[model samples]
Structures are given as C-alpha cells and as structure tokens.
Target: MTKKKKIKISELPNFDIVDYLKTDKDIAQYLTVVLEDGDPALFVAAIGDIARAKGMSEISKKSGVTRESLYRALKVEARPRFETVTKVIHALGMKLSVHA
Candidate 1:
C-alpha cells in the first residue's frame, strides 16, 4: 500500500477573485455569475471584489461617491440603495441592463 501525504490548511494559498479580475470582460462575467446565483449579499461582495481589483479610490472618484461610502455600500450584507449600486456600476465603467 502507498501512503498519502497530507497538506495543512495553512499551506494553501489564499484565493482572491480580485487578483484574477484583470479585464472588463472578466469583471462582467464574474458579476453575471453572481447575479445568476441570486444571492443579494454575494452580489454585493462580488461588486466589492471588482472594486478592489479596479482601485477603490479611482472608483470613488469616477462615481463621485466618497471612498468610505463605497466601502460601506459594497460590503457583504449591506443593503445599499439602488442609486448607490448604479453609481458604483457606472463608476466601474459598466451599465445595468434588463433582458427578457
């Protein structure tokens, strides 16, 4: 019989989606998948991830929202206003659209 080696939990590298979101298409697809999941909190976290990837300061500048406010609004379990969500999406250089 062959023996198997065990790996410690700490041995695994941290997986951050923000690190992989390198392009607009990547962000779009990520958000799309999260939206399909239909979990509001998950969607918010996904947006936060993309925001971090793009730079919170830059997003705040483009969205005309304070960086602190962006962080508060995008955090998981945060029930931010629809207007704020739109602002962040626009700031991210994307738009929200409805499909039939």
Candidate 2:
C-alpha cells in the first residue's frame, strides 16, 4: 500500500492576481464569447470576471473610484461615461473601439 502526504493550508502560497490572469486567458476570451452570445446575464458575468482579472480592488484604489461604481460601469446595458470607460480600459490594459 502507498501512503499519501498531507499538505497544510498555511503552506499554500499566496495568490498572485497578475500571474493568474496571464496564465488564464479565459477571462478575456470568455468576455468575448459572451459578447458574441449577446446574452445580458452572461455579458454581466464576463464583465465581472474581467474586472477581477484586472485586479479591480487595486484599480479602484489607484483610480480613486469605488468598487461599486466600477461594477455598475461594467454591468450589462451600462452606458458608462467616457471617462469611466477610459479609466477601466486603461486599468485593464485594454483599448476601446467602435464599428460601423
């Protein structure tokens, strides 16, 4: 019989937000997929995921914006102000575009 080793919870390393985001491209990909799907709930969920992936707490701190405000701006059917959108995109290392 083989014996298995047990690991302590405290022994686990702290989570690295940037490292996780880099490794998991799903956050961005999922958002794109949701946008394609055109489902409001899924879109909102994707926005939340992106916000978390981009370190919403940190971004909110740096941008001097409340987390709730950020969430509202990212919600489906939200017509966020140009400045707010710019702040979010800049924080997430993304660019915004428009199409005809």
Candidate 3:
C-alpha cells in the first residue's frame, strides 16, 4: 500500500504570461493562437497581456489613446471598438491581415 502526498496550490510559483512575451515573434505567435480559439474575450485578454508586457504607457502614447482608456478597453471581457484595436496593434508595431 502506498500513500499519496498532497501539494498545496500556494506552493506553486507565480506565472505571468507577460513575462515570457519578450520578442515580436513571441507576441505574434501568442496572439495567433488566441485568435484561433475564436473567442473575442480571450483575444482581447491576450492583447491586454501583450500591451502590459510592452508597457501600457508607451502603447498609449503610440496609439494616441489615454492610458486610462487603454486599461479599460483591454480589461477582461472588454469589448473595445475595432478602431481602438487597430490603434493598439499599430502601436505595438503589428498589423492585421486576412487570407482565404
């Protein structure tokens, strides 16, 4: 007979995806995967993660959107407008494209 030991959830190290998004390729790949999931909220959250990783202050300046607005727009389950998304993408040095 063997006894199993239980591990406490609090013992696990904290993990933040933003910390791993250190390069353009990494951010692109992450966003692509989120898009493939076909969930708008998830995609929005992914963008928010990348924005945080890249610095919300800089993104807001480049995107011409206020930092406060960006925060609200990118928050979880937020339904930001297309223009806002495009602006943020441009600020992040990325673009959107379509293909059949």
Q: Which stretch of 10 consecutive residues in model 1 shows the poorest summed lDDT?
A: 82-91
RMSD of 3: 1.3
> Which portions of model 2 miss their true places by more than 4 Å?
1-24, 39-45, 77-79, 97-100
What stretches of model 3 exceed 4 Å from their correct place? none
Model 1 residue 39 distance off true place after TM-score fit, in angstroms: 0.7
Per-residue lDDT of 3-100 in model 1, one digit per residue for the tens?
Answer: 99999999999999999999999999999999999999998888889999999999999989999998998989799988888888888988888999
Worst 10 residues of 3 by lDDT: 68-77
What is the lDDT, from 0 to 100, of the residue 28 in candidate 3?
93
lDDT (Cα, tens digit) per residue for candidate 2, span 17-100: 334455336556655677789776655555556777767898787666789998887766676676776676566666656689
lDDT of 3 by residue, 15-99 (tens): 9999999999999999999999999988888988999999999999999999999989997779999899999999999998999
Per-candidate TM-score against the hidden true structure: 0.90, 0.52, 0.91
Q: Report lDDT (Cα) of residue 24, candidate 1.
A: 92
Q: Please give the TM-score that candidate 2 achieves against the real structure.
A: 0.52
Question: lDDT for each of the candidates?
Answer: 0.91, 0.66, 0.93
Between which residue pairs do clashes occur in model 1? none
